[model samples]
Target chain A: MDLTVKIRNKTLPNPVGVASGTFGYGEEYAQLTDLSALGALYTKALTVEPRPGNALPRLVETPAGMINSIGLANVGVERFLTEKIPYLETLTCPVILNVAGSTEEEYASVISRVDSQNAIWAYEVNISCPNVKHGGMAFGTDPVQVERLTKTLRKLTDKAIIMKLTPNVTDIALIAQAAEAGGADAISCINTVMGMVVDINSRKPAIPAISGGLSGPAIRPVGVAAVWRVSRVVTIPVIGLGGILTWEDAVQYLLAGADAIQIGTGNFVTPDASVKVLNGIISYMKEAGFQKIEDFHGHF
Target chain B: MKNFGSSILNQKEIAIGYREMTISWPQSLEAPLPGQFLTVKVTENPAPLLRRPFALSGFDREKNTASLIYQLRGPATRLMATLEINSSIEVLSPLGNNFTLPEKDETPLLVAGGIGLGPVLYLARELDKNGFSPRLVVGGRTESFLPDLSNLKNGSIHYCSDDGSAGFRGTAVDYLKSLDWKELPSARLYSCGPQGMLNACHNLALEKNIPSEVSMEQMMACGVGACMGCAIEVIGPEQYARVCKEGPVFDSRRIKWT
Candidate 1:
C-alpha cells in the first residue's frame, strides 16, 4: 500500500509527478487541479538570466505528439526566488526545481542562489533540453560533461539531484551511469526525442527552430525502452516520462523498471492527468495484489 | 477556469470548410466572454492527443449554450466534425484574458480573417447588445471560405475576399483604408486573423492614430499557462507572453510585431 518514492533523504508521497516544463512552477495548475494530492511537481526550467526563448511557431502537432522549441524560456533565478517561490511554498507536494543554463558556471550559479529555499525539495538537472543551441543537450550527450556537471552541483546542495536524460543520444545507459558515478541520487529519462515536421504548403519547417523535442504518446515506447536499458545500468531510481496520458500508460513505465513516472505532454491533454493516473495506480495495485510501487517493477 | 463536461446540441457546416458547433454549457461555470476560449478533447483516442483550442463564437446564458466555429484544416477539426450530437466531451472553459470595452464615444471596428471570424463576430454581437455601434469586416480567400452571415444581424457586417469573389475587392485592412476616416473619427480597432492580417491591422491602427486590440492565434499544447509553448513576443522586459494566458487578446501597441 506504500506508494511513496524515496530518493536519498526526500520521500515523495506517491509515485506520480508532473513533468518539468509541463507544470510551470506548480502555480499555473493550482486553479485547475489539486496540488496537495500530487507526489511531486517539477517546475519549468529556470536559467541564470531571463530567456527570450525561440521565435514564433514554437509548437507543432504530429500524429500523436507535439514538437516544442521553447528554448528554456523562463524568468531567471532571481525572479524565481522573488516571484515564483512564494506560490510554490504553499503546495503540499515536493517541488523539484528543473534547472538549466548555457554554461557550467550558469548552472552552478542558479543552484547556489536558490539552494537555500525551503520550498524547493530537489533539483531536476536539465541537461537534455534539445531546443537550445548551447549547453542543454551538449552537457548531456557526453558522459564526461555529465559527470563533471553532476559532481560540481552535487557539492552545492545536499538536496536530491535527479539528472534528466535525453533520448536523442546513442547508448543512454552510459549517460545514466555517468550521473550515478557523479553522486546523483537518481536519474530521469527520456527528456524528449528529437523530431521535425515540415509545412508542405509553405515548404518550411513547422516550428521556427526547424527541429524540436517531440513528446507525447508517439514517444512512449522509446521512453519505456530507454528506462528499461538505463535502469539495468544504474542503481539509482529511474524516473520515467514522455507521453504518459492515462493510468495505463503510467503502469507501462512502472512495469518497465521505472521507480516512478512523470506525466509530460499528457498534462496538456488533461489537467487532472496526474491525479487520475495516481488513482488508477492504486486501483491497479489492489487488483494485482501488489502492495508497493516496486512490485510493478523487476518482473522482467 | 474550470473543466466542464459538455454535450453537443448542434453541429452544422455553415461554409465550405467551416463548421459551427453548439454545446450545452454548465450553469455552474461563468459564461464565456467574447475573447476568452476553450479547449475541447476531440476524442478519447491519443492520435490527436492534445485538446484543440477554440474561441467562443457565441454564448447564450438563458439556454446555457456556447458555440465554436472551427475550420477543417487539420486532423483534430476533421475528427471534431465527425462527433455525433448529444455525445459528451470534456472542455476547459473561459480561459485567458478578454478584450476590453471601448469608451462610450468610441466606435468599435472588429475585423476578422477566415477562421478568426469566431471571436470578432461574437464581440460585434456583444457590442451591439450593449448599445454600442460596432462595425465588422470579415475577409477570406473567397466566398466559399466565409461563414454564413445571416445569423450575424446584431451589427453592421462587411465581407471581402482576396479573389474579389465576395463583398469588397481586397483584404480587410484595405477595405478599412478605403473607408472615410471622418465618419469613424473616434474609432478603436479589434482584430483576429492570420498574422499578416493582424500586422496590417496593427499598422493601419497606428496610421489612423487609433488604439487597437488583436486576438492572436498560436498552436497551443496546454491551453493553460503551464506550457511556455504558444508564446508571442511582446514589447516588455519579459520579452514574451503566452497566447493562452496573457492573451489571445493584446493591445496592438504591446506586440513586438515582425
Candidate 2:
C-alpha cells in the first residue's frame, strides 16, 4: 500500500505517528516496536534550558482520559544536542522535534541551533502547551502572535515547520490561517484541552498545578472537530491528534482532512499503539480497496 | 526492561482490602532486583487506560514465581483484585531502577509504613540471603493497617502504631528517636512510607550521620519513562527526575523532601 503523506518537501512513510510527549525521545520505545514503520516520531516539548516542570501529583486519571501538567519537563537543547540527538540520529524514522519557548527570540534561538541537524527532518512548534505558566498557549491563542512567532521560525529554518495549534481559542480557523500565512508547512491541531479534575473530599484540585491539559478518549471529539474546522480554512497539511486509540479513530481524522494523525495519550494505554494503528490503517485500506493515503483524505 | 504477559498463579487476601498475588515467571526472564516494579494492566479496556505499577514484594527463583502485595486504592486496583486466578495479565516487567545494596560492614535498617512494606520486605529478604542481619521498623495507623511479618526470617521487627493498639504507642519517627543514636552510626537506612515519615527518616539519618536511601511514590501512566508523568524534584543541578526512569529508589540526600 502507498501510505505516504507529503507535508511540504519531506515525505512521511505513512499518515500514522505518535504524538509529542506521549512517545519520549524514541530511545525508550525503540525496543517495543519497529521505529521504521512509523511516519515520524515526535519528541517531548524541549525548551532552551532544562525545565524542572511542575511539582508532584503531575498526573490524574479522569473519566475516559488523563490530565497532566508536566510543565515541559525536559533536558535543555544543549543536553538534547549532546545527549538525546545522537540517539535520535540513529533511528530509521524521521524525528520531529517539538520546540517551545517563553518568547519569540527563544524559539528562534532553539530552531537556529537545531536547524543544522540532519537527523531532525521537521519541527513541531509547540506554541500551545497549557501546562506551562508562561508562553506556550499564550502565543498560540492570539492570531497576531501566532503569525509573528510562525513567521520568525519560518525565517530561521527551511525544514518543514508544523504549527501545533491550541483549541482554547474562540476561533481555531483564524489561528490555523495565521499559521499558514506565516509560511507554516503544516498544522497539528488540538494540543490537549485545558481542563481540571477536583478532589471532592479535599475540596482541592487533584493535579498539583490546580489545572492540567486533558488528553485521551475524552478529548477525541474536540480534537476531530478542531482538525475538521482548521483543515477547511488552511491550505497546509493538517496533522490531527487527541484520544486516537484505534485505527478507526485514525481513519476518522484522515476522512476529516488530516494529512496525518498523531497518537497522544493512547500510547500510555498500549505501548505499541502507533504500530497497531498503522497496521490497522493498512488493513482498513486493503479491505476498502483504497490504493493510497489520499484516496480517503477529506473524503467525508 | 521487557514487556510481557504473566499468568496469575494465586491470590489471597491477607488483610481487609489487601491481597498477596503470586504470578508465574518464565525461567528465560531474569528475576527483578529489590526496588524494581512491574506495571500491570488491570484491564484490557480503555476505561482504566493506564497500567498500575506494583513493587515486587517477593520472588522465588527456583519456583519461577513473583508476588506483589497491594491494597485496594482505586478503580484500577479494584479491577486487579477481581481478576480471576490463572488468567494472563499483560505486564511490563522490571521497570525503574532498583534499591542500592548495602556494602560490607554496614548494617541495613529497613523502615516502612502501611503498604510501603512491599519493597522493604523484598530488600530484607535480599539482605538476609547476603548473610546480613537487618533490623526492620514498621508502623501503621493501627494494627490492621500493618503487614504480618511472621513469615519473614532473620530480622528483628520493631512495630509502632498511632492508636497504640499494637507495638509502641507513637509515630514511626517517634519510635526512631527512642532508639540509641550511638548504635545507628554503622547502619545504612532504607525507608518507604508516607511523605512525612520519609522526611522524618531523612532528617534522622542525617542527624545520625548515616547514609539513607528512600523509595518515592508518584502517580504514573507509562512506567517506562515515555510519558514523563511521574516527575519528582531532586536536589541537584537538574531539579527534576522521572521517578519511573531515574528511580523509584533514590539516596535520601538526592530528594527534595519539601
lDDT of 2 by residue, A171-241 (tens): 99999999999999999998999999889999999977998899988899999999899988988899999
List, for all models, the DockQ compared with the true complex: 0.83, 0.69
Highest DockQ against the true fold, candidate = 1
Clashes of 2: 0
Would you list the clashing residue pairs of candidate 1?
A1-A291
For the second chain of model 1, what is the TM-score against the true structure's chain B? 0.97
Q: Is the docking of candidate 1 incorrect, acceptable, medium or high quality?
A: high
How much lDDT does candidate 1 score? 0.91
Model 1 RMSD in Å is 1.5
lDDT of 2 at A109: 88
Candidate 2: fnat, from 0 to 1? 0.69
| Tens digit per residue, CA lDDT, model 1, A144-258 | 9999999999999999999999999989999999999999999999999999999999999988899999999999999999999998999888999988999999999999999
